[model samples]
Target: MRKHWTIVTGLLVIGSVWLTACSDGKSGQSSVDSDKPAEQAKSYANEPAELVIYGAPGDPPEVWNERFGDQLQKKFPNYKFTYIQRSGTNTIENMIASGAQVDLIYDSVGNAVNSVVATGSQLDLSELVKKHNVDMSRFEPATVEAVKQFGGLYGFPVHSGGLVLYYNKAIFDKFGVGYPKDGMTWDEAIELGNKLTRNDNGTQYIGLGQSYIHVLSMNAYSLPFVDKATEKAAINSDKYKKIVDTLIMAPAKAIGYKEQIATLKRLFNNNDFMKERNIAMYVMNFGLQGQKDFESLDWDMAALPVFKDNPGMGTQPYPNFLFISNASKYKDQAMEVLKYVTSDETQLALSKKGYIPVLKNESIKNAFAQDSNVKNKNVVKAVFTNKFASPIARTKYDGKLNSPLQTNLIKAILGEIDLNTALRQTEEEVNKAIEAEKKK
Candidate 1:
């Protein structure tokens, strides 16, 4: 799945009251001017300022253009907005290195936050967040903390995607099994999976299918790849080992095997598993892809099962962040756009397009309530409520460190290496990568 981040700059400090204005011979609503006090009209009226926004490719820019860009163009006659599209973090890294005079950059909080901060391409938005009195009350507390690294706020979130359990409701009903509950444990999920698995004629059904082991790893450890405060590899700890063991040993042992490749192929290609809807559960991110599949099947989503003892340890999800470029001349104007986009109205509007808006206001909740297709409301609500676990610790050298660790993890699951050896090798590789990054 593609992760998108949108950073806005040059937002006007406008009041919260609404105002009416005539534009292009049409009467419409506009925000109150920034010159007014807090008690005044809630519209943004300011001189037009040009802004260069760099964002990930696809629907995000179009949504932004519709919600804020077009409106800003009409509201501020002097401002010209230009949007540049880039795909993937590699492109972003290249653009930054080429001295791209970008005013904003969007990225995920887990992978891109520390890297961007290290590059010094992003500005601290703390003052602007405070000046706008942007309500941080609506966000999941962990999400808020995720955006804050070392004492400065590098970015603000526009939306998030959490982990959820997508199950075939038709298959469950056919087998006389109950649907997965909102809060379930790993053990319980396995039991449910066992009950759901069956064979129809010559085809076999599976209980669970997982695309990414990292998701399982996250649910187990409840931390990012690196500890933000400690700036070190924390995944080799006992807690993480338990997580790794559970995901690998439990499922492999149950099936009487240790090969993940075989498991994946068996789960996906087995006629009864996917084609026949014999599979009970598949763990995936909360995105349009899941919904697209859901539309084709009688499926529903629930929160990923938590650890038996640590009920709080749920799936790890990363939200994209918006940042202001250090090179932008129209910082104030960009800030205004940021503020406008983060507002409750805009957030709610975007939510309709299958995004979990960053704003935690009543408008967002009301919007979700009105949409019947958004069946994963409980999962979303849980994420916002911090019902999930903290992300795995990540280091600045995560690309170097995590890639190898992830590769070895896959190998371990395939039985190419034992769990203890994988862990030891991962520790060695992580320490080496950390050392290399420290030298730089």
Candidate 2:
């Protein structure tokens, strides 16, 4: 029977990697000899197979094909790869719940937390790794450990990256404001942004304003939106309130609260930092491509700002993860694909395209400096200088409960609701969601 490629949506945390999938275009008996070398034997060599690959949001098919698909196809000519577009977290959850015949799931380790693993689609790859004698030690120990923490050998690391503050040097120079330094606290950064915002020649330059979603998603404090133990939204807590208050108030303090509300109504775009050159600092999950986008704009990046109390805690680590589905009929074939993609050769290939290869190999790390468009800048300090905040356990309703924090926070920022009121309202909405999920 021909397998169908499934398209579903899901959200996950940030990381950087290029992913590809390949299988024999047809499902059938293997043509390879059983007595071949173990590595050779597991290749499912010469079988016509079709690999179903489900993508996370923002990964484009063309980019995947260019990055790894063509090369993978050259390595395994008999295997045909199919790419399915991501619709959202809900879509992927539904597909997995329904037992879709997906071969691989691609996303950051964060996004996979409650969605894929909770759905029972993530396969335990410990046995397969042992059978293949794959040297898991070749990759970063932390990345490997991250996958293992998902409660089994649930996934493999592709690459790892994290959030940073990309600032426009020209904007800083124009405003007579100093550039953001690495390790600066959020309060210090905001104070600096207050200096950067001003009217220049009739054009209003935003000191620093990141998207509400970006702010909540990559909060340097890694504040939990839902307390997993209690399975309740923690929006109204003092810590969360402080974090949200700082974020919402900092930009408003910089540009004036009234103006900040007006700007929120219009919504700030990241592109404005580059094309319009009106935004001074854009905090986001920094990748090679994201850095390259600012090359012509005379910009540099600083490490993500730290919280005042948690001086060293930064945004969560984003590691690209590859998960083989438990429902996959071709475990051996899937393992082979995962092994190849995580191989040093493939890691090097992905690094050239701006991904931070998961391999601890110095050779691969050095390669990042060679072709990086922003290598001359402090890319290392910006991306690697900080420590990741502690991770929170995710529940099945985590997304539904957690997702509202962003939108409602946006409402609070836009002055439609007070921060405290917004927090209470979101907490109630999240409680309702949790209750609804329990009934189902």
Candidate 3:
């Protein structure tokens, strides 16, 4: 059995650039005492060769670098592992386009994966998973299904994440409002938010913090920021219209209520929630980065409210996938490292540093429960366990189409554009993008 090591905490840099200079797996090397005895080291020398990994720069890596990366280097000296972290999706996409033969690529599930697949840069990992004895059963079924395409497994799960509602507990208590429950409806959440908001020194704070237009589009209609199949816009659904109405429009219409469109800008710059101590709720991802700033305030988290009729389901699960480049010279060695990195042991170790584990191992589950900073374990667990439906397929045009669609939608909410006309124009613009992509 592989040795299980724990990771230690350190100051987290929200986003950092990771760069690795070119080097052969051997030479210019430093050796550390191996955990394995001499005989065992000799026995493991038969393992496959070195692998190169390229990943997006972000959380967990800053902390897990020493334990995870260093230990793997020591155990498998023959398998030289190099990690290069790029800043953004566009940078990573450029590297892939340039044919940088990376053994493993770390990226978001939908758009990033689809983009690379379009460029013919990724390998089909179905055989790799079987050969390495990856335990697919350990992952949530929906998460597993999300990575499959064209009857092939293009990638394996790395980290699983979903949206959840973050609320300042002190505000709820002050207003004599009950805390949000597991199955609370969106309408109930909105009403509760209204009750908690007030005019403080002439600055108005409505109930909930504003969400990104993209996130709003996702939760409301299960639409993807981009679509994979048609490479077109898929944002013109009735579900999205309802989302625009409730989350954007309805709130804007409330008397003395500030516009939701300006919510994110205000919260970040004005310390909207932190200052007033009256903001009821806001939605964000599971990682909860930048939350330390709110440590001085009492707060808790809840599941993103579900549509009343849509009951158990709340939000779509957005997970990151690890894929091997088809052009990699060290494909076999890379698969071995990928398997080790995604294994239950590694997943649990990474989760300790804030990345959500995809595996259902008891240790990872316990670690999540014991995390003191994570105010709402039940909400996270509920998102994983609930029988939620998969998100609707997104077209390649969705991302390009969202800005204008949201701009028009916001205008409708502000009573500038009538709802029907706004939606019709949105449909027309999105369809045009879809048609252009089809011709491409």
- What's each prediction's TM-score? 0.75, 0.77, 0.77
User: Candidate 1, residues 322-352: lDDT per residue as tens digits?
Assistant: 6776667655555566665566655676676
lDDT values of the candidates? 0.57, 0.68, 0.57
Ranking by TM-score: 2, 3, 1
Ranking by lDDT: 2, 1, 3
Better of 1 and 2 by TM-score: 2
Task: Say which candidate scores most in TM-score.
Answer: 2
Backbone clashes counted, model 2: 11
lDDT: which candidate is best?
A: 2
Give residue 4's error in model 3 in angstroms: 19
- Candidate 2: tens digits of C-alpha lDDT, residues 340-425: 77777778877766677777777776666446566687776676667766444434565774456666766776668888888898
* lDDT tens per residue, model 3, 195-313: 76676576565676655553564473465544556554544567666776676665555554544344542222225555555456767666553455676867667767777667777
Overall local distance difference test of candidate 3:
0.57
